[model samples]
Target: MTSAPGTYDAAAEAIAARLASGGAAARIAAASSLFARGDAIPHERRAVMDLACAYLRLHPGRDADGEPAFDADDESVRREILHQIRERFLASSGDRWDHQQIPLTLARTYLPDVDLSKVHIRSDRFLSGAWVAGDVELSHATIECGDAEHLATLDDDRPHFQLTGEEGDLHFEAERAAGSVSLFDQLRCHSIDGVGVTVRGGRVRVSGHIGAVRLPVLTATQGVSISGLVGCSFVGLLGSDLKGEVSIDLEPALSAVDISWSAVHGDVSIFGMALDHGAARVAIHLERLTVKALHLGGARVSTCDLAELEADQVTVRECDIDELRLDGALVDGGTIEYSRIGRLSVDDATLGPSWVRDDPPARVDWLGDESRETVIGLNIVGSTTEVPPQGLIDNDCVGTMGDLLLDGFPVPLRRDSGTARSGAK
Candidate 1:
């Protein structure tokens, strides 16, 4: 053993030959002299993590699109060695790592509310990352990320997130994962997919139990609520620009709602949306609303509120609206294409080739029928741009059919018994 002196321990081979080389500022000064060395000697930080995993197995930037750019100066030397490992070995209570199973190889640190259900996130197959600064609570917790199918991709340099999970059975198998995930209002989760994670902003309250949530680029500044979803699918929102206040509560009459394309501003409520599971029929848009039946098949909506508005198989496509309201209404069946409804309201209504307005609305207010339950199916084939004065034509008004012609009528009728209804109490 005396011969071991010359066996190349030349000060641990000069810090493993300056962490194996001269590129990227000598690997950020040998990763700040081997993780700032304050691991306080556990076989000298496991011989500097076995010479940093043997120079990451002879480095091709350690594979997976050539890693090694946790940038911003390696997140300012990994939050100053995690504030010197939380002031030299984090232990103020039951194991913050004093129980010593700390593995933050490709480093980034912040562990605030610190209830990762007895944290054992050991992802060191070759360096991923970690962060949990404030409000992290998984009450029946589990974070089991030792080799989470080789998880990576979260070096956005965002070290500020408030996380919460409650009432037992909380788990995340993390891949490109997490921060800005909330499930309050009666939060009940036993399963929420794994390893395909991306969270931007969420609040699924109203007796919330979010089962299926998928996000590609969902960013919210405030207000996101969700509740009561059963075997539901809103089909992959194509051109997505949905912002704050996204309220979804679907589980009524056997739950059916599938939103498409997406360009909402705030306040979106969906309760008991119908017909889904790939028989493929879903369209939704309303302002003043009540529903026992609504079938908007090629859906695009700004607001829909029809109190007794049971328009069966309702459909509208290419919708670009500023306003369209029909109260105390009931018109059945659906189809309308290339829509532009700025202000079209028909109160106490009845009108109906399944009531498809082949692009109607510069402004029309029929103000007929308030309440006695008899306004049957409407088919208004008119208005190139706001016209309704041919006796304000009734039998549900008619003037043109095919390229839809009707020039001027109905500008003086504002009897909105004002049934002010959108949805979600």
Candidate 2:
């Protein structure tokens, strides 16, 4: 039987009475009967709220006082009831549950493929250890902290989105299938954990300020793009295989960004990013990363560790970095034009024709511990200083003599025992 309009209270009272009169089996039967009749369920909003309240009432935790205690079998029955309500009553609804407080603590639950797009949840949503069958479309959805008044009293310069405690964050550690995960468009949340997730297909586009996102072991078949993040502390994508282009752009500042041991088939672009100087110093790690082309621009960081990087083309433009280590890198072509770096180390690297023209004279350390079998082609132009040649190996000038001028003097290209050796050219 369908409840009349504006009879949400009556429907909720009926559900409470029916569940109160039954044990585990009877309650499960009541849940099945209540959700089986689609017309008996109220609007999506009221139906979700009432059903969630009933579910919490049955499976009350330590905070829920004056509620009837249930055994393990009753707990299983409560999960079944929630599953029926989610799959049958709410999944088919096209309405967006906006500006509502979802009281269900959905941790460790098995969720079906559902569209929560544009849903504005005004509370914490915990989905840790949940397994999803298909795509998780969370584009334009927001999960706000329940304690807003306390957040407003904090300092503005500090990172307000860095939230702690279980009740103040959105825990989404669900494992999804080979469907696209869209987490962009002002999707504000305290933090997210996708470490246990593996996206077998579709692009994983993540934007907005989701504080301290940890997706270290995520394996996305398609590429991933993360941009427009503000006040983000950390972004961990270690040991991930993004089979397509990997693009990342962070605004203002961040603590650290690591993509070590990752492989990308397409070009990797990291621009418009600046590390926070107030926080501890952490390099933008690209160690052992294999990419098609690597581009770095408009970034101001303390250190950029590119040791053991395998890239076809490496380009650095308009950046202010303290140290740029290219040790053990296997790059085909590289250019450091129009940048200011404190120290540039290229020890034991097999790089093709590279041009180093940095402002304020960057220190170039291109000498390996021992002599190399083959000569390294390096073209250094502009006013770079402190180019010591005590431990120079087989190094030669890349371009013409005019293009290898350092301090307005042509660098001496000498030959020792039929092996070409040069200094700062």
Candidate 3:
């Protein structure tokens, strides 16, 4: 392609020819020269796409088994190439590449390792069914999807966008803005590390088989819904500040789930979760968590650490918990109905009646209520305070009570027997 001096067409031809014919070193030299000459040439999207395609064609990255090689050294070189292409060749004079609209769509395709770290994109990206060979480094990147109408036009029944890191994990640490990230049916990655990520006004939904997920120190203004995690070893959401609802639905055989030191403004629901029952006996950690309401259903965990929790209401229905700890918690009301709890501890906690008012009236499902709940060992010692009159009304303890320790009024021990006891220290 012949063009005038300092034209994008000329630069494109030069880069393409060098990548097609020259060796690796020669190709690098050519790309460097052209990329550094960004101030002289005009920035054209076609030229950028053509150069990227040429470089990808040069490194097809397939092994003898017809699979992506994903070699470490090759990935390093690819990262450098793409970085130079985006930063120098595609950027205009006196402008960083962060203010670029690079809309990309590669559905049902095969891609090698990708590194978009530190890049900012102001466009929609669709990678539905795209199989990535290696790691996807998105650390410090800003992804925005401005086309809400276009996103709404996508078919719901379409295949879930696949970001399978066959050889490596997905790195999302220190991300700036993840605008409207919707991973439709499921995501199949080896693992996801989203430490120190910030999602300003968008929601994050991922449902599928993931090896592990660590999203500690996250800040999300909107909600986060992650479900259908089958055989995932661990899920860590520690030290997060979520301003919306949080829902996590796990399988029965999960190892551990930790959401300590987090604050959620909306309801938090966890369903179908359990801990490892082997020799180690991993447990679920919810220490120092604050939420509006918490609901746990169909859970069979070894231990539930609900110490220092601040919530308006908490309900644990249809659960088979080995140990339920509520030490130093300030909860307005809670119910443990229709469950088999091994041990229930309420040391140094404040419990009250339900503040939620239903139109048709709510069902009475507290401890020792009409529900078919069975608590083996109950402990209410160490200066615990319950609301007057309505608190500890029906003492339906099927097992042993360590101490019927209360602050103010005398409480009954059983519904069948009229035994009013006062502070059995």
Candidate 4:
């Protein structure tokens, strides 16, 4: 098959010759052949070769026994390749492969079964139709690449798909300043790990089931859209300068969504946010969330909608200069403490005893309350209460015709409360 220098046949012959040499030089030649024939070789052939090479390199003169023939030092590169396979295609173990590397200026090619576990890629590694094995670990690995439109489509044909490192470990620090990294299908990981999975100044579209994603500091600048179920816990989103809306469709009914410190300039709507502790920007919308502690520090919520929520406690510290809407909520034991609000509306919501800040005099009238009954509005302790003329209240004077409670005290339920209290009309 030896032909011209630039011919495909010539390149295949060169690869076969190198594999036959059986030495470091030969191994390097073989590696070069695999890289060159990334797209040329079929998936089945590549998989089989990868497995054989790893066994030979790692097992090292031992035939399925604890016997050693070749020295580990003599076969280090081969061992490294096996590690790369594990990290690149298989699961990541604590033992990392740190010396391997991938060139950046390489042509846009196809890299099947490409392993980069614990490997520090000095250049931007871009490949199309890349088939990755599950349980791959890229903890503390950095990948910086070229501009937008450069795509890397991972395999989505298999089930139980995931990209994760060891427990409490990161997978990859892929930085495509302008390019894109599309992770399709199901991606699973361990909790309290995956510190930073950033997609900065680019577009990252992931259509799959993401579980146990932990990024203490997560930033999606420029354009980053994450669709599908994001079952992540203990996260912090900062500076999400999305030109469009950021939508998240999570599991219904109290799905835990805890953001330590997150700020989104664009609108954020989560299907359910069981917030343990976090800060957010703009607006926070939850479907069935259980918020333990929440702080919207100087964030703007045009409408804070809560649906099927079962929050034991929710505290909106600081202040939010926006409209607050709470609907169909079932809070067991918590408080909705607001420092100051532009407009607040609570409709068909159940609140466990709460304390409103004594900052502004606002209006609140809705259903389901465990506080004092009032005609127009209930007067919270240390806060002023406003009573509209036609507001409902429960009183002892009339059976079902009493005023709403003000400050846990029974008040008359009358349409003309101001006039009645003033003894007019």
Scored by lDDT, the top model is: 3
lDDT of each: 0.34, 0.51, 0.54, 0.35
Q: Is candidate 2 or candidate 4 better by lDDT?
A: 2
lDDT of 1 by residue, 1-425 (tens): 11121122345455445444445565556555664552434435433443443333231212266533343443433344334333333233342332223433322222222233322333322121222222223222222233232222332321211112222221211123223232233322322222212122233232323343433233233434555544334312222344555555444322223333344455454433222222332333343332223433222244443333443444444333334455444555454443334445654444433445354343222312211111222244221222232323223312221111123123332124321222221
Residue 94 Cα positional deviation in candidate 4, in Å, after optimal superposition: 23
lDDT of 2 at 180: 18
TM-score per candidate: 0.26, 0.49, 0.65, 0.36
Candidates sorted on TM-score, descending = 3, 2, 4, 1
The prediction achieving the highest TM-score against the true structure is 3
Candidates in order: C-alpha RMSD to true structure? 18.1, 14.1, 8.8, 15.2
lDDT of 3 by residue, 127-176 (tens): 33334564344444444444455443432222211112333322211111
Query: Candidate 1, 342: how far from true, in Å?
Result: 20
Model 2, backbone clash pairs (residues 3+ apart or across chains), number: 0
Which is superior by TM-score, 2 or 3?
3
Q: Can you write out model 2's per-residue Cα lDDT over 1-425, one digit (the tens) per residue? A: 44443233455445544554556777677666655533344343434344433344332333267523445555656666645534432323564233333322343343333344334443233343333233344333333333334322321222111112223332212112112134343334455555434444346566654565667756666677888766567777887778788888855656677898988889888886333333344458899999999998767767898988999888886565677877777887766644545556665566654444333222222212211211223343221234432322223322211122222333344543333334444
